[model samples]
Target chain A: MDNPNLGGEPGSLSPGITVLIPAYNEAESISDTVNSLLAQTVQPAAIIVVDDCSTDGTAEVARAAGATVVRPPKNTGSKAGAQNFALPLVETVWTMAIDADTTLAFDAVEKLMVALDEKEVAAASGFVVPRYVRTVWERGRYVEYLFAFSFLKPVQDFFGKPLIASGCFSAYRTDALRALGGWSNRTMTEDIDLTWRFYFAGWQVRFVPDAVSYPIEPHDFKFMRKQLRRWSHGFVQNVRLHWRRVLAVPTLRMIVAVAAWDAMVASLALVVLLPLMIVLFSAPILMVAYVADLPVVLAPILLGAIRRRETARALASIPGFLVLRAVNAFFLLEAIWSELIVGRPLRLYEKGH
Target chain B: MGIPVITAISVIFYILMALTILPILRAVQAIRRSPRGAGRPHVFPLPVLAFLMLIGIVGGAWVVATLAVYRLAEVVPNVRGLLPADGAEFVLLGIGAVSMVGTLILVLSAVEVLSWFCAEREPKHARGPDGQKVRPTDLIQGGVHSGRPHG
Candidate 1:
């Protein structure tokens, strides 16, 4: 789709949206993030990188990359805080919150904008794929995203509510986002929070699976642990906070509840129940029971990855996903135990690499 | 084991089962190779050595004694000569431990292989405008660098 009318000339592209990237010490990726947005097929009218008190020259790098730099007077510790800090400066009818570490497909914005024609659609997100898939953590995330976006997202979209308008690469109706106070910092996950609020405000969220965004997934175990912890805590926090209000929407409530239940069961099974069974029953052969799940998980990945390149990558990454599942289970159980049983709410917001 | 069911359904099921084994094989191979980032050798963390120590000690004992119990017994027909004169439960314990240790190693290998895969790949080359090669810092407008200096 040609956006010739949406050219870079000032006052040329009327009602054109702006890109807002929130960054903190992302000097390495800031330029690439901005450049990718600038190179989009449906080019945004403006790109603003909100620097959240970086020790590095993030602001200068962003400015050099053609993104107008906006820094809070003081450090906005969390990603949501930084995005909210720059929300007022957004003048366009539509605005996108692209993370500094993410790059999008050339036609991502073009595809995302397609769903917004329905006036009720408040937000649209593209599929998320990892930029770097070399590391175990990265490969695991690659498969995780592949399964979630390719399989789960389509089903969620059919029911008219995506689990989230993923934070990394999503466009929002400027007014609708502002109405919810521009990504609440009440939870560690602003994306989930904002998406639920949009539904609560009677706005629809769409997921365009074809529009892909590649963000750097965590590579190291330390980084992965931090990310998983934040994610687990954020999920529980949102569930605890939104459960009362979200129950009003039947489809969303059912989906969220089921997902939560499944996660709990699966986590317990992998990390606790299975091991306990093996020890108690002296069942060494039962250990292979995990092998049964291989096809169930890999089928969707292979189906999603029709291309030769993606198929090979998916095949290579399957083991990593198994590792990730155990890690996820461990973290989820820890989060639930800490938050629900121990009555210790996870209040810290640590950004994933 | 059961009836010889050679229908298309069984054939397809076997084919899928065979395909699933490919990933398990690849995972085994990945951990065997030393990981490299860019052109440099990547060292496995100290924890890998720690895991290997446990597996080696436990697996080594089981393999040695199990060999004595099974292999020697088959050849000599006198297991007590090789192993201690023990209860039948001891024999069961030896076999069970061997299988359990074998399975444990497989599980741990999958994790170690992933750790190798998860190590960060070094950036190939920093790029300048119009697709020209540039210094890493030059790619960033402010000349900010994160790692050991490179192209």
Candidate 2:
């Protein structure tokens, strides 16, 4: 079949861009995702969705939407495994990774290409806005994502170390990705790991804020917790794997910020101590003491909320988002302690993805 | 010296040890049942394992020390009320902390096993007519479906 996006006869021109979607049991969303791709202004040379042995008719829906589907012999692993399945199939110079439940904006692909074409850019990751956020938890996540995408990522890019590339809409220069040995199959947050790997290899990644994709957020607390726990564990694992790079370049603002914040937040002593501070000290005294340390404690949260207005509103609902942050903090501490002190191999799937 | 102290110490130690052993036993059983070399057991590096063991030991010691303090308080009339009404709360907190740490270790070990298994059994490479790895782009053009289709 001739691809109109390549700007020539099918056989005459090489595939310039290939979009890969890693899917598993996404029957409800696959068709719309494929249709969105089909409706792209600058279409991909081809679309390949790697079905990770979904019992649902995800493969059939993808096929009907005009995407070529490939199912692995066995469920190889998780999202990373599915992407690895599609890596060998990409014949294009650039490959875009889009989640099955996400819909890309019409110009997302074109903008990604433009960003990748820039000098020294190894990969281009786009912004993800939550498509359906019905519950309070989902709304909170929507806010968190905005801060991550808009403020934090851009700041990280300026420092030359982007922490994560949203899996929903990320593009990679094939050569750079292949040289880095594709994606690590063992990690849950492969996109984050890959971003760090590219950074360590001295490859520059760009944040294309204009390139957008709408992804489904968890509608309830249970699903939200599962997602956050997986992400928290994955973040901890990646830190263990790349602590050397982080330590070597201690001057990077984002690195310093993450280390400082994570250390303070994850200290079990701090959580237990904070409540004690309230109990042992008078409320007035505690409030004064906290105010004295307000900048450090409240900076990330307030800045995070301001940058993501939707998230700010979501944070307002729970009165403090303390439970969310505390649970997330606990998991982060657990992950770090497990990997570093307990000599545990970071398990990505035990939390039941 | 008394039975109550010894009983408390033994019960606490046994519970801690069992918590540690359960996951390790499950992991070892999993490794043994898999076909030989089908999956490698996930093991923390020696240095890392040593560090974790040290933490576990220190944590275990803290539990013993707390129990010893409580026992001493019980035996000595002068220091009996020194710990205050929240004494039990502190003891519970200590146990809870140690249990959480132990649980984290178990989870880490489990993840290591699963990661090793997944890496070992990655899908076979799809080869082309030239014996080169088949590119997805090529397969799409060739229109030949190869691999077992899912039901």
Candidate 3:
């Protein structure tokens, strides 16, 4: 990889593009992720790998592979904390935050760059599609992501208030990033935190679906549970934290409020209420509720699968998504219970496999 | 309606109504919150309008089917005997129509989802106030940016 100390002038391809990869014990995947970034059509001015005080040779491997590796004196506790360690070192006008385990498309950076050109776009993120589809959890997430990115995100983008700028593969103007205090540690999901903050501050965030990034997701139930817990809690936490400011941003407030209501109520409707109604009342006709949203769910999954030419995979995964959705209700319910009802903060940063 | 039956009916009724209203409410909210004027909101874009139409048709079909079933029950000896009260026919319509509506919503929602496929994923840009270029840095300093983000 040629050292891309690239020139930063107007019209220059990625003139001041600096890529920041936040990692902890990512030795197995760090080098590959770094290589993919280096191989991008538009090379970044610098690639800084923040090892986050990993016990593994993650830092050594990254440095050996030619990335300017930075390991904080102590563990930053989360991916956001790790990314913040390298913020001061950023000299370029633009910064791309890439997760250590994720790899980007060749033209992903180029596509994201287009958003940065527009002054309103504070951060532009690529679509995240999982690299593996073998596990039930992975397949379920694939469907979830498909529905989210393919249908949900476009609407959010249309309103110009995409709920998130997506942390895994997103670009932000460096100066703008610092002003918001970089990746915040206030929430477990820093990407969501930063995205909402940007929106509240009157900055625009873009979702470029074509600029794809692949990150390996949890393949087993144990890891899936942890990931879901953090995510669910993080979502509710953000709502609690930002509801006031979110209201000020019209579309964002409504989208988030509705999403929160759905997360809380849908679980009750699907997991608890459905069974209780049938078991107690013995209303055989009420069974319709169980399959009522089938079209709504299946339509997006099948269409997404057909577009990717994975109709069979989508079909096979439909059942998996159903199971996952039920399980999601349980975990989400627990998160809401713990975070909101019990009033306990989930402080530990448990890495979801 | 019997006490338990009334509770069941009310539960089913409100849940269905909630299901139906949630998305529409969201769409309208999307428009209201949109930086663009009410002339067009992202939620009610052409495709979404078509989806709303299909749902409306489904709701309309349920009303007609319920009325038909109510009339049919009056003529059938066994069905008529099942309704012992003066308002029994109305109760029958409520039960019958809701179930039909549920089925219609299921089918149409599937159709609605099917219409959504892979998007072009292009970034659409709009200028801020005074036609001046507003950047993220500017927003940090409180730039005059609009609500519609790059679509």
Candidate 4:
């Protein structure tokens, strides 16, 4: 599996790899991200940061940190468009999609290449750890990453389809990516959408737990709520687009089954129950009734605790997390209703804080 | 018993629903018709539809309630008598009139929001190196600033 002609030698360097960072108003973190990439052991041939018309000096910071900055005409609606805008500019054989707010490990690129080479994989996604986990919301997201990276992704991979490849850190074989018409500009969850598309196009995606990238997690309630809302809307949008694909592909059966179960049972359950929980807490009698039903509810929590001790600790932030979840569910329900009944697309904007 | 009044209310409700539902239907159809793998439509029409539906249901209920009160006034002799001696019937009519107007405004606003949603644009074309219809990657020359030194 060696290509000596394309600067590839056995246990030697391969062709240049391009790290594309799509940034939108990430002035606070762009410099650090660039610096981290500069320090990488397997240095990227180019670091292209697509600044989507940031009003702030995000492009400047990226430039100062030694990334080649390309500014879009305006915010092109999403990160997908930004990548699409920069795809032609990338000359490297491999491209790594790195978020502007995320800092990659020094060995991240090397580790990804090892996985890609060994498995003959078309794409590989690395682990995303939260940069600051001091806050409750951040801690919850840390647990979420653990569940995703350690448990869920493995399960998804075993089923022959990975549900989501985080946009924070993912490497792709340039040819394979370009052949799929690049990322779809219309999708909010383009990362997840592209992963599925790549899989369907006969490309296997490997998960490299060692190739770590640290992304800033939402530290406050408002930010967390907005983040969750965007994620929920994106999830709905992705599901709507891929529902037919999952049905058409036999290999995707288990993955589709698990996703359906999660969407229907877990997502809907949280949405319905959160609102009810709020209402119940407002009433003394209903609160007492809920307390009596605690055993039924606590069983799942207890089981989760036994299975994943770290997750149990994270779940202690349940009150705040539930509030965020309820907010997200409200937006998700609205988005779903709009998509299913009204026949409209879902719009998720990161307009304000 | 007033046929004209009932007819007017029903017409308004239908009109409201039509104004609210038509654009959303159009947006949805557009999304369905668009190419596959393009991603979720911009959710342009749904939010508007949902908002309108909420207002229509709530406002319609309020209108119905007011109409019911008027009917009560007509049915119960004591209730009619308890009303203001002068122009009390007109006052009840005025309340219904205001409610109907309010409903119309609510429906109209919903339509406005829906229109805004539908107006959202899709991603524009990616330009090439020669200012032609090009792939997105052509914009990157010499692999994104090769001359720049690493930090």
> Which structure among the candidates has the greatest DockQ?
3
User: Against the true structure, candidate 1 has what lDDT?
Assistant: 0.71
Q: Show pairs that collide, candidate 4.
A: A87-B137, A88-B136, A88-B137, A88-B138, A89-B137, A89-B140, A343-B28, A345-B41, A345-B43, A346-B43
Residue ranges of candidate 2 with Cα displaced over 4 Å: A1-15, A249-260, A263-270, A282-323, A348-353, B1-151
Candidate 1, superposed: residue stretches over 4 Å from native: A1-14, B1-151
Per-residue accuracy of model 2 over B67-132 as CA lDDT, tens digit each: 555677789976555544444444444444455456555544544454445443433556755567
Residue A275, candidate 2: C-alpha displacement in angstroms: 2.5
Mind giving the per-residue lDDT tens digits that candidate 2 earns over A246-276? 4434223234344434443434544555467
Residue A72's C-alpha lDDT in candidate 2? 91
| Residue B138 lDDT in candidate 4 | 34
lDDT of 4 by residue, B1-151 (tens): 2434643664475456546644644554455344433444564645456456434443344344444444767998766554433433333333433454464455445444544455435336454444556433333343222333344
What are the clashing pairs of model 3? Answer: A119-B134, A119-B135, A160-B148, A160-B149, A295-B110
Model 3 residue B122 CA deviation in Å: 39
> Per-residue lDDT of A1-353 in model 4, one digit per residue for the tens?
11112222223334778989988889999999999989989999999999999989998888988999998777877877788788777777788998888898888888777767734477888877778767777766665565466545643544345666677799888877777767775556778788878777877786666688898888887887677666666777776777655454554544544454445444454566433644653421112221222222233334334544645565565454444444555666766777667877657566222
Overlapping backbone residue pairs in candidate 1 total 4
When just chain B is superposed on the true chain B, each candidate scores a TM-score of: 0.30, 0.36, 0.29, 0.33
Tell me the tens digit of each residue's lDDT in model 1 across A1-353.
11112213222334878888999999999999988888989989889889999989999999999989988899877888888877777777788999999998888898888877678889999999899999888999999888888667765765677889998999998877776677877887889988998998899998887688999989999899999998888888898888766766656875676567546765776788668866875644335444434544565578677632589889999889988988998999998898888999877887788
**Which residues of candidate 4, in runs, are more than 4 Å off?**
A1-14, A118-120, A273-328, A351-353, B1-151
Candidate 3 residue lDDT tens string, A1-353: 01122223323333478999989999999988998888888888999999888888999999987899888899988888888878777888898999888988898888778768877778988788888888889988888888787667766776687888887889998777777778877777888888998887789898777788999898999999889888888888888887667656666765675566557766766677667865765543344444445545565556657867988887877767777888998877888889899899787878887
Share of reference contacts kept by candidate 4? 0.00
lDDT of 1 at B87: 27
Q: Assign candidate 4 its CAPRI class.
A: incorrect
True contacts kept of 1: 0.00
* Candidate 3 chain A lDDT trough over 10 residues, lowest sum: A1-10
Each prediction's whole-model lDDT (CA) = 0.71, 0.62, 0.71, 0.63
